[model samples]
Target chain A: MLNNKEYLNKLYQSDKPLIIYKTDKGYDIYTDFSRRIIINKKNLKYFLNIQTKSKKSKIEELNCYVGFFGYKLLCENIGIKFPKQRSKNFHSGVFYKPQTKISIGKKIIIKSIKPDFRNISINTKKYLQLNKKFNLNLSLKQYSKIFNDFSKNIKQGKTYQIKIAQTYSKKGNINSIDLFWKLMKMNESPESFLIREKDYNIVSCSPETLILKKDKTIRTKPIAGTLRKTKQLNKNKALTFFRRNEKETKEHNMIVDMERNDLSKICKTGSVKIDKLKKVEEYRDLFHYVTTIKGVIKNKMSNHDIISSLMPGGSVIGCPKISTIQLLNRKEKFDRNIYTGSFGIIHSNGDMRFNIMIRTLLNFKNDIELSVASGVILGSTAKKEYNENYIKAKSLLDLFN
Target chain B: MIYLIDHEDSFTYNLAHLLDSIEPTFVSNYYEIDQIKLEKSSTIVLSPGPGEPKDYPLTTKIYNKYKGKKKILGICLGFQQIVFCEGAKIVQQKNILHGYQSHIKVTNDKSIFKKNFNFLGGRYHSLKMAEPFVSQSMIITMRCVKTNVAMAVEDDINKVYGLQFHPDSFLTPHGKYLIKKILSR
Candidate 1:
């Protein structure tokens, strides 16, 4: 019998598309998919309307499609049209129906249509590292100009809050699986995952859950405020700081209300309520203020309806999802690709879970890109927000060191 | 039917949900003001949106044309619109309060806000009707306890009302009751 790392190495060496999603217990490894669907601007709406075909499977996790929706597709779905901008022309979205699954937790469980026990020697000694330094797409001066413009918009009442994206890129080649494990060891987040495909790869340490639907209950955990962690600052102190700081509290309040409004659209009347109020979540280099809001799903609400109502989540996009998105798209010179998009699974039984794709690295054609953003409100300063963005990208950049 | 004039704001749906609980509500973008079936709607709600009153000319037109004929209510930007259309100078507030909860005190005892008396409301705006709103028909119904800015206004005889704070926010516990009171009138 092979060990957990050996089993993962075997799957990674199989050259088949795979996804290793982190769960509360351990990791769920899916490989050898039976079918794949690639979505674009033309077929997005058509695919959204199509229901997931139910299959006879005793394993609940196996009867689902695992994939990601890109940021552009999400914007298009919500009737937001972007002006012509430079883009890498990435696929809008993709999903896979897996045939083999392995659950790694207290006990190793394997379920597959055709189980493959064949294994080769696994080398767990190598550490992955990037060969080049990552360069930010925007300079401080340029970011200041854009921040001033956004401030003007806020003053003019065009938008209350907006999140601006900045990309850090470099040319490098490293084993994605190794990188995922290394990053996991450094900063393991709840919504983290690793995807290895033929043409591209994605490794995410996303901390925000955009949607988690189980039966009739739907919940979203929106993260709004962030504080850089120091040796003196602890979780309790961070919570006090968030509560006492008027700017952080206001930003958090706006996002909470916006998320509630989003849930109210597809939820039963008066069913939406805050399950967890402003709480502090400790990460490696920062502390985040997060709130969990849940609602009872309205009857006859389809998966499409739920996705449309919650995709490109408000916390990442800022308050007033539609107009803020428009402002961000207009100001951003490049495509967001999958930065703020969602990644998770949609089960055949209509149960689904997705996370906002922040603090993620996208590797395509030997070029790797990591995107991070911070929310700007009325009282936010350009220098503070810019440094905050760097703090968000630090853990990922630290991997190279 | 309560016609909600959406100014392309994020909280419009929450407002719609609030109004729907009182009566069947229909939502239309502010640009579609001319197409609204004026005779069918019992009330007109100018939703909280993202801009100055001067940006939405059609809403101003609708308010001017039907101020006394229909029950009109405004929120945030909508509140500024009501005052701006009534000859009050809309100026930038010294302290912009967005998503800040403020203690509200009802100034006019006979208006609809008399029921709630004083309460906390979620405010999201950067502009306010300049102080000393010298208007003949409009009366300040509520003021923020901290800033003393006009939080609400009413023209009882004209059946027009405005609220500078957002009643549809989760932060405002009395949002439902306040909307109900406005609809009752």
Candidate 2:
């Protein structure tokens, strides 16, 4: 049970690149101080997409991945072209692909008591700094218009579902490290992790699981439906409400079907089945409907094939994933960066889990941003959908309160 | 006026069109049904909702209040609630059913729904009344073709009906027709 401050101090002090991925029941802390691989756009050539014939080493002893998959990276890799736009392409992912050779000195830490942990002494003066309020990137009207347009798209048979995202930002004289620590304390999620880079920092408590692989079994948990949790509402009542919400169920079922299709790509025929369907998973400030789809990997199917099949998790984008992504590329204003991206670890032993980058706070060039989105269906209304974003943001916003 | 209890289930919205088409004055919620209003209404329709029978204790109270006095039609969760109030126990199925479409074999449709009621029905329930939990006063009218689970129960003596499947959902082949038949009775 590492306190937030201590964890931040240790994170800043460590020279090695590391990743801390918290699971539903536990957390995994991985670090490789002696050897760390950084995957960037420049080195994109070194990487191979899924099922490439130029495949190099098929086995790696111990590989620890400590980065994310940008929404664009997945689109480009999957051969789905995005609409030309002025959006900036910030450094997206820093994946450490499974290497052929053995790396013996890697570090692995597992703690049961909320592993977004490390203990550190706090500076009282820094703690007393003024906190700034966050502001939405789009106003209610703009969000409404976008939501309405998405609903129209759904009606026109353009797409069955499309995830509409909005970013919240705040500027102030603040400490990003302290904010990261506070977020971890307030809204600790299954995929909770803090990534400290030379120029930027990411603090996340994401609730969505993107990709999980263990040996021949590979799975993806796509989260779709959402409802804000409040003190006035009883747990049973809330669960009932969420369960009967037709709009939410439709959104959730679509993604579950999409995830099943994705897994079927590299999975053995008749091996794919939904392990869990529409289970209401309650988080701190919000509750979500999540379904876990699992499939056995086909023989000789490399990790690349699995990632390609399921990169840019369906829940974050939408059904008919590629086309909706293209539509969003033309629509959304700001770059998603690592917001809709994924952060996880691919172990050397072939076990891995990545979290969809929602409920995540990232600081690049000292500017902090957090993102929240709702799945848009034909029945979705403009105001209601936009309001859903605030509900998603409430947990993180509660950190300030 | 048709009194429709709003259980806050999203599927309850589907009942709006069917109810409105039948009665000009439609009020939502069983609590809103007063003695005079309940007497005046054509029928009391319990809208489909979430949760098990016990989760909605109010529905049981309504069932007790107007058992034989008024026409009653319960759909989905409402159906489970009706049977539970009649001394029946609802048990969680080994495999929870949701958004599943299948045939419901009509064993005895001599009560309200038309004869030869064997038709495509859609179910979305995690709990069902199997052989043991069948209500003492209610008759099992229909069962799913696949799981053989109880799909419809009725107590014609009390003028009460329950359907495990949602007749209001588009998945049901004869949903509108079945709803009209139940209400017309």
Which DockQ values do the candidates obtain, in the order shown? 0.66, 0.02
The 10 consecutive residues of candidate 1 chain A with the worst lDDT sum are: A120-129
Q: Give DockQ: model 1.
A: 0.66
User: Model 1, residue A323: what's the lDDT?
Assistant: 79
lDDT of 1 at A317: 86
Question: What is the model-wide C-alpha lDDT for candidate 1?
Answer: 0.86
Task: Give one digit per residue, the lDDT tens place, for model 1 in A1-401.
Answer: 87766676677666567799999999888877888889776776565556364665666667888999999999898889989988988878998888778888988787777556444444343323355688899998999999999988887777888888899998865567878999999999999998988788899999999899999999999999999999999999999999999999999999898888888778887788899999999999999999999999999888888998888788888867777888888889989988999999988888889999999999887678999998777777889999999999999988877
Kindly report which residue stretches of model 2 are placed more than 4 angstroms away from their true locations once superposed: A1-18, A24-26, A32-62, A84-88, A96-131, A172-177, A232-235, B1-185
Error of 2 at A71 (Å): 1.4
Which structure among the candidates has the greatest DockQ? 1
Regions more than 4 Å wrong, model 1? A1-6, A56-59, A115-131, B32-38
Residue pairs in steric clash, candidate 2?
Answer: A6-A118, A6-A119, A6-A120, A7-A118, A63-A348
lDDT of 1 by residue, B1-185 (tens): 88899898878878888888788888888887645466678889898888788988988998998789889999998999999998888887878788899999897776766644889899888788897887887899899988889999988888899999999987788989988887787
Error of 2 at B90 (Å): 45
